[model samples]
Target chain A: MSKTLISARGLRKSYGKRNSKFEALRGVTLNIHEGESVAIIGKSGSGKSTLMHLLALLDKPTRGEITLNGHPTARLRAHKLNTIRNKKFGFVFQSFFMNANDTVLNNVILPLKIAGVGYRERHRRAVSALKTVDLDDKRNNKASDLSGGQKQRVCIARAIVNDPKVIFADEPTGNLDSATGEKIINLLFKLNREKGITLIIVTHDQDLANKCERQINIKDGRIVSDTSADAEQDDDGDEEIREIIAESEEDDDEDATPDKFEGDNNIDGMLDQKHPVHHINIDEDEEDL
Target chain B: MKFLDIIRDANANLLRNKLRSFLTILAIFIGSFSIISTSAIQAGVNNFIDQQVDSYGGEGYLAVVSKDSFDALEGLTGAMGNGNSTPIEYKEDKIQDGMTPITNEQLDKIKKIDGIDGDSLVEQKSLNISYVSSKKTDKKYLIGAEALPPGNIKVETTTSGQLDLQGDEYQIQLEKKYVDVLGYTEENIIGEKIQLVVVDQFKHTQKTFNVKVVGVIAPGVISMGYSYVNNKTADDIYTENTKYYPAEYKDHVVAIAVNYDYKNHSAKEIKDKLEDIGLSAMTIDDIIGSIKTFFDVILTVFKIFGFIALLAAAIGIINTLFMSVQERTREIGLDKALGMSSARVFLSFSIEAISLGFWGSVFGITVSMILGNIANNIFHAEGGFLESFPSFNLATYTIKDIIIVTVLIMFISFLAGTLPARRAASKNPIDALRYE
Candidate 1:
């Protein structure tokens, strides 16, 4: 019943000169509706990332027609395209591309900063996002100090902090262990269900593919199969993911030494509220406190 | 992105690469340092020369000499062309004929010319003076007295116009160092009378007179230590010394000069009138202007060397910014992907370049000013190398020139940054993100 948010027709992308030219995507067509959890599953060199890039407006296809909210975006100027990208779309890459020198809160708040949001409001929202991911206690830690799973969590927080209409995650838990991977999946699914945001995930993991409501299989730059799951939701899967998150939370508490918990108690007090009251300013020095 | 946010991001990025940023700034520092130092030295030298010239010459004055003294051979040739058949008996008086002064008739004639407001006669008579109250009686000082045309003589006076030499009070001016020879303090020697023995060159006899000292003047590079006699006293001595000379040679004035208001008359017109009457006039401005022109050429040459250094520094900035663009390809791509416009990205890098110029010039000016003070102490020290030179400064700092150099360097840095900023702005976001 959801309206279509983005639709692409006859998308084509090629690389290099005529004699040495290689095609990445060939006449691929697809439609993604709002509030739908969709996954594009493909092997290596199958152009799932290329399709994601075009849909996100991060690139221009060699030959294609793309429409967003009923407006054709193929001829839109760069600034307008960037505006759409900044306001409506959020991306989480497989590599967890975070500024190593910046604090966890700063990494989460960068999009708002770029969007020219006020200092106090962005700080509040960044803290709320971090708390949702259960990393509010580590908001002041440098991004480099975080473990791989924790890094991925920060990336997710950054992706959702702006409340975008759609979230594009490419192999969201590819680098984590099974327990950490399950925790990431639970966070992503919680955001999708709670916010009603359209979620598009590209992954080779079949277990991750089964959780989505719809799946598109791409091979050799073509869609081989497009299938949709039944209306019956996976209650058992949700319960199992919740159990994994609970065990990880217990482990996180055991490892939280006195030094790590210094300012964390104050953070927990702020996050305990449905909405934080004190408007903290988001700056480099404010993170340490 | 907002302009302020872009600037802040640029600052943070530069701070992350502190060593590279500092090294780039050092190159600009060297360039600006040379420019500031050279400009200071030039200003100092020119300022000193201007002060020296002002003190050396009274403003708006002209100098004139007797036509015979100015054109000695021409007058003699004209006098011989009168066609007297008898071969003139050439004796001492005949040998001194060409050295005659401007006659009273000539002075009266000049007074009637247009724009000739007033005239004065400079008496040229050699006299020997001895401080009468001094312990050293054997030392006699040779002095010359004259009513010199305003610009001809350069004398530095400690107390100007203290004595009216034309008044009947028979007074004289003594040199400042006469205190040492007279064996008395400066205050004590003011009212003292000194004996002068006038030795006439033509008459070959000495006549003695005593004149009271009224004021003191200092000795300088141009004017050595010579005492002054009042105008009335000078006339009396001149009449007595030449009393036995031939009647025809008796009434000649030493020199005849005229004064005209500078505001009313042009120098060219005055010079033209004087030349018509077979006389020449020299103005102080003409002499000073010619001297300054010589120094200006030397200053221009020094400035060229500073400009060359700045040009090299500009090239260094361009190269450094290009390298930074290459190194931060992925970062730029991320920024673009995050919703930064191409203009904002260009502006961010441009601001970073300007900041480099700002720091370099600020440091250059500060360090140069400190060094200028140190050099001032060494070169302008008492009895130092520059001591013999009057009113000389080793370095002089001016605010206007420093601001100009800073602006020029910043402009060059901005121009150099444009190439790399454009390259960054025009980059394809997908390609940049894939830079790896």
Candidate 2:
């Protein structure tokens, strides 16, 4: 719909070295346009997440060229890159990634705080962002007190608080129940449609990827296929995606995708164990009783 | 980030672990408290010594006496006394054995000495002084009034507000007890006439004269019985009284005030020169110098203890800050990911350390000042708990000293925080984010 917001060419990321060198992303080239909704989809360790990270500017690629809004970022200094990350991008993670001890409002205000906004202005903007996510009444509550879906909503609010040019959600709804996950996907689509914010998601959920206008399937550290649907008629092309999903499900039993969790046995695992239930279900059960 | 925002962030981070932050501040507190308290006490003692030295004939005047009389005056002034009636057994040693007093020839030799401005004869005649109220019969107040050379005596206002002495006034600084016998307050005693009767026991003849009281001084070592008189007037009175004395007693002078500009000549040089001329000289500075050395030694010992406590506190700061960095790993990563530069991260931690030092020093100084004032109040009350000791403040810290101590504490804290801050700054955001 618009000029390229972020473009990456010949991106590569490898772990270990020499004989043990294992590449997570190899020669990935993609361009994401402004206000576009794109999903990088693959099973675990298929280099989809690594490709997203490369586009997000969270890590330096071993070899690549990334142009952000037509500015070459290959040689930008770390501090300059951090400024770009703060002012131009926002990120959401699978585990909600909220600071459990801080208030809901502080969680959303963090990006603005890093941007060095004054306290009163930060408070006002954070409150407005929370209201956008319908969490304004819970502004003073610690993140630990929020339910899983609410925590994800808070993460979205934080991601949009700086009003960045792009939002990166890596498995944003992976931990939520199906109904809640559907709501979160709808929220991401609504932001893309209403606010004209670019949305890039890394996920394996076929149902979620079929909703986007563009879907790139990564397999064995390479792009196996790129598919696009008419923006107003993405549902008309979902039948084809459903067939593809059925074929992948048959292959799931024999799935041998490399375990991304093998070396990633720290953050994601720790976050998952930190708050599994969110206790909202138990509270609802008590209310039912 | 702006510098103020960085400080604000650091403040919030420190609050995350309240107990650790408070403990670190307390360590700095202990160190600053000891240093401030010791400095206050040292300042108090130094102020007292300065006042006492000022009260004793301070500068530019030398006490010229015989080697024996020099020793006697040193004993009279050095010993702790109220300076009323403690005579220096002047009749026993040299005078009874027929040794000649300081003669006019000796005075001329001193006046001719290089660097000598002018000299005056000190009237050492034993005079029985009495306040001339109507009733005065058998109470004889023996006082020694010295007539100092020109420009040697400077009268300063005492607590009772005595008037400044004018030219050629016949005045006496009466003893505290003696003034009380006359039923006159120190302020009212000015311009009152006092009778002085010089008695020559060998000749059995007494000469009497009346002198007007001018300035009143609290009796101390320098002036026994608050005794100071105008040089010319006392010289005239002495000459009048000695008109009938025999030849042996006519040339008898106990001491002389040698008026050398001592700024060019050190006290040691003057004392040595006088000794060459068969005389001895002493300055108030020489005596006070030794006393100052004693106080300085005590203060040095106190400072050593304070420094040791400070060293221990510095170690405590290092320990606390290092632990804080370790615990705040994830938080630090979050800040970096939020676009905080490594330099800002480092500065934030450093500012936190400095703030810890600031609060510690501020609290320590405030509490110590309160305690010091309380102690001083106790020591200054009527018949104070410390009445047996000399009347002086026990602790007094100046604003300059307080500022210096606070800055010193902050600097040490900043230094102690450097290593920990560097560690936090150099932490890889990826690894720190991965840290649980």
Candidate 3:
């Protein structure tokens, strides 16, 4: 497994009356691996989104520490935080909060723009990103003119355009129709698979949670079940997995691109398993040659 | 962010409310324009006064009131009585034994004074008479006369036979206007022909002297001050007003030219000195009563106008800036979040106001120039009072006008922007982000 890139210990956020502090995240702790795809699952007010915000350094913890890529985040200056946010993190909110006044092309180029990207190169990258979302023809269309689903897709393009190390989505499908939501999820995972970029998503949808290799269920900001799909059941031997499985050297092809084995290599309902050894072997084979 | 982005974004935002922006700029333009125009006109008046004074030789000489000089006689009728009063209803038929005349000795004494450049003595015959030709004409008194002084005063009379006033000065240099008109009344008046009957109370001289109309001398805008009068003792006593002397007539009115080299000086010093010598001197400033007084009435009217216009312009600026603040609330929030200080926000808005003011002043000045020129030409064509004298020129050019207008506009804009910019900058980023 990759080293932990971010860790939040006892993170909490509260809102409301002076005497009544309605804690959003009550002592939440979570770890995101360097390149892992992790999904946080819970019903409404489960503190999943709050936890994501804390992890992304978008919110400060009221009573705890949030360390991002190994550096403590609470004491960071605003300029330094902005720089880190610009270069390291990308966001895909549920509503795809696009600036309604600008064209799709401008929206796609906004992050690069805030980074002071040159006009020509910025447009070129923006166009390429739009093409990736299959919305290149609509690049000049105002964001207000786009449908809910199309806007979300464009937002995803904007997020990945910077080639950031982590893409954090807060209920990436909360606003879209069922089919469109599924499409966005598929697109997100596909891009994650292709780029080996970390994807941290928080969602209430069980179907979405079923797809990620690791699932964390937050019950009152405490991670009640942080079980991996096949983690030897923490010495108690329990997994929803009918089967279990998964998984650098910068060179020598040891951590090279995971090649396609050219077969019906499907890993579905793989979260249920008795022993995780056999799936672990497949991960090892997937590692190098 | 790139500089271009900031410019383009600002332009785009400003475009959303074009009327507001234009009105803002218009306020600036009018404000700056009025200021420059007002200043230029003030400059014009100053220039005019200076030109009028300078055109008549220099400013050192004063018109004084010596008890025996001719001006004292005229000024004594000023309702302000002379030192110790005796109304001289008529000229003294004879030089009284006790009477003081400004004599040649006094002139010589003045010549001995350290700074006496020169002097001129004057006599005047201010009486009116009538003449009937085949028709008739109004009896115009000698419209103008030069009171010649001592031979040492160097009276330059342009009379017949080249009788140099330096060598053989005459009684008067009469204008040919009288002789030329005499031809209509009498016959063959040009040369060796006509005579004028000279009469002025106790005086009737009908001796037909040869009409030596040597030259027509008219005092123009620039005339030399070398004219002088011969001593009264030099003239033969020919019974009051019937004498044609070989030397210039004794006008018995003295003018002392004090040698002052400075442009601006205390006239009181010279006056006090003259007063010690039993002469009363009044400076140019005393005569004109300070150039600033000429502006009192006009300035009062103009200041009221300027005040009202400036107030309106200020309102325009404040309104536009407040709108800008409201429109760019989120953008300002974003900037603040990016660690921009409130002062930077203030500076940006203030600079924008200055820019608006700057352009307006340029336009205003252009209007003033074009309009001022048109006014001058029209007034001159109509033979108006301003046209009769001359113009005060303080011409400005493209570079100079631009620089001046820009500065004025920006300064006023800076003044106008203060409250608005402060209000905008004071908003907290958190509230501003949530602001509509």
Candidate 4:
């Protein structure tokens, strides 16, 4: 609940030639609050992934205005964008895209490495991030050898290694089993609560979308809907959000209402007893890894 | 950021692809090998040539007649080029009494000529040589090679007993080993009393002096590339005693040293003028040129061999460069995408090619030297080559050839880098990246 951290307006992306131009994203505007847990959900190819990619600075927009923190990314140089991405953004992919040659610790520590942190310090920081995903024991193991779920956990650890302000997950649970998917979802929301880290995910699964505090849906190349999960508890800060995802059942043109992901902050009831945490810190600054 | 780190990392990368690097460097090794080995052999040949030429002083040299020497040798040899060129026999023919009447007047005039630095009219008075060594009884097939004044014989073989003592008509460079002897070895047994027999216009033996053993000479000393060499013809024939017919012989030969003033006129200029005065002038060039047709054949054979080696090395270099480009495809793409110019890539590979050639040359040179030495040791060139026939000095190239070889190698390196450097510059960034 603070000033907007990101605001996108008139974003667009297209592929192919003029006559057969396949538009990935059309003009869309949205605002995201500080430390907000937001998920954009729709059926596959509804411009959800393109939205995430644009927000993540992985690719430039064909035509758009996207402001992160406060600066416009309309024409930032590749090196400058890489610097911002390294210092402020993190990503987790459905395929668990970790470099096979690197150890679990090294994969987690890459962002900080790109940020030019010292070797000893990066190692120490990466170890701590590994602990976050309960994968400290597998620190020296090569990322390539990890199981599917374990690989996802390693990716989660890497996303948080540099203490990034924004963590983006593009179909984070698409490859995991049902039980593993629930665990990962629980972990994402836990970080949003305890550490006040911003979270954004692009998913086609409606069940996964219902778990987030807010959902922004896209149809064709345009935003079709944006709303909370709880229709009546939009005012009270303690609004309960149980998973209400209807992902694969949605149509391209269906209007999506935002899903409420927050629960009562004082009880910690919704979370498993296994989860552990401390005071929340939502500072705009980042800690060096 | 760190220079040493960059080289270390590059070196490690090179080590990772050991086979590729070795194959690449092998081209250089072969190229340098060809250049170096050939040069070493050339050096050996030149060294041998120098030993032969060293005995003749410098370049090619000769002394001959255009007309006649005496009735026996009249026109038995080739002429000195022109129809009326000076005959060298006249210089000796014109000399009578104790003075060269025509030469004293032209001594300064000869000096004023364009390429004539100095000249000597030599007289060799053959004395019956005696060995004082008690082990000898009328033995030794050697003569004290004696001559007079600035007049000297070209003693190609230093082992010969060419006496170096002071004597009128006897300035000899005796082989150091045969100094003082009062008798003869069995080889020279006409008589034991080694003395000079002086005679007048009448047929008579003016046996004046019983010469002490001031000198003796070894027989085998002439095997060092000599035009006029002898090994004790006959002790009695040249003794200070008898002759088949009576005559007062005052004949001499001319030995001229040509001035190295190559920029000015030639010695042939004065040689032409010498004929009018009944004199002759011959140069080392004429002597060396007489056998030039033979040398041309040798040069043609060596050139073909050297060309083959050089061509093979070039092909090796081209192969290495192409492979290197293939291996670094992704790296090249990354560099290009990151703003590296193709020219820089070309330059880098060019340097590599040049270095490869250089190291190859070095190795080749070394191997050649070893080969040369082995060959020399195995087939010792008996001193007969120069001593027997027309032998040329082979050391120290004409300076022109030295410059030629240097320019040749540099040009070869440039040629070797040709295709490789171009291929490196021809890579496309997008295509190369997609090569994975």
Fraction of true A-B contacts recovered by candidate 1: 0.58
Ranking by TM-score: 2, 1, 3, 4
| Lowest-sum lDDT 10-residue window in model 1 chain B | B127-136
Q: Weakest 10 consecutive residues, lDDT, candidate 4 chain A?
A: A280-289
Docking quality category of candidate 2 according to DockQ thresholds: acceptable
Predicted structure 4, TM vs. truth: 0.50
Question: What does fnat come to for each candidate?
Answer: 0.58, 0.42, 0.14, 0.00
Q: What is the per-residue lDDT of model 4 for residues B1-436, given as tens digits with 9 covering 90 to 100?
A: 1233233333444455568656655654554445444444455455544444455354323242322232213232324343343334445544332223334445455555555445432223344443222234344334333332232334453233343333333222333343335344333422233333245324553443333332223223233211121222222224433353334332232232334243465556556755554555455545454454455466556656766766776777677667777877755653443233566556656666665555555555556556655555444456634332223323223344434544465467657777877876677643454465
User: By lDDT, is 1 or 2 better?
Assistant: 2
- For candidate 4, the lDDT comes to 0.55
Off by more than 4 A, model 1 = A117-125, A228-289, B2-5, B52-286, B289-295, B387-391
Q: What's the C-alpha lDDT at position B211 in model 4?
A: 36
Better of 3 and 4 by lDDT: 3
How would you encode candidate 3's per-residue C-alpha lDDT over B1-436 as one tens digit per residue? 6656654665555556788878776776666566566666665665555544443334555554455554445546543654565554445543442224445655565545444444432222321222212122444333333333222222222233222343342323334344455343212321232222234334454332222233332222221322211223123222234344323334543444344323444566655655666665555555455554766457546745755676687778788888788877766764553334566667667766765666566677778778767766665565664543345443223455457656755687788888888987787654464465
Question: lDDT winner among the candidates?
Answer: 2
What's the lDDT for residue B386 in model 1?
A: 71
Which scores better on DockQ, 1 or 4? 1
Model 1: per-residue lDDT, tens digit, B1-436? 5567777777787787888878888888888888888788878866765555555554446555555455554455555786433333344643365454655666665667666565543434543332233333557555655432343233445654355645776667777766557665567767777666666566667677776777666654333456566667766766766677788666655544445556777878877776676666666656566656776677677678767877777777788778888988876887787777888778888887787787888888889999988888877678777754435666888888799989988888888888888998887766776676
Task: Find the candidate with the highest DockQ and give its number.
Answer: 1
Candidate 2 lDDT over residue span A89-144, tens digit each: 88777777677889999999988888889889999999998888889999999999
Q: Which of the numbered candidates is closest to the native, going by highest TM-score?
A: 2
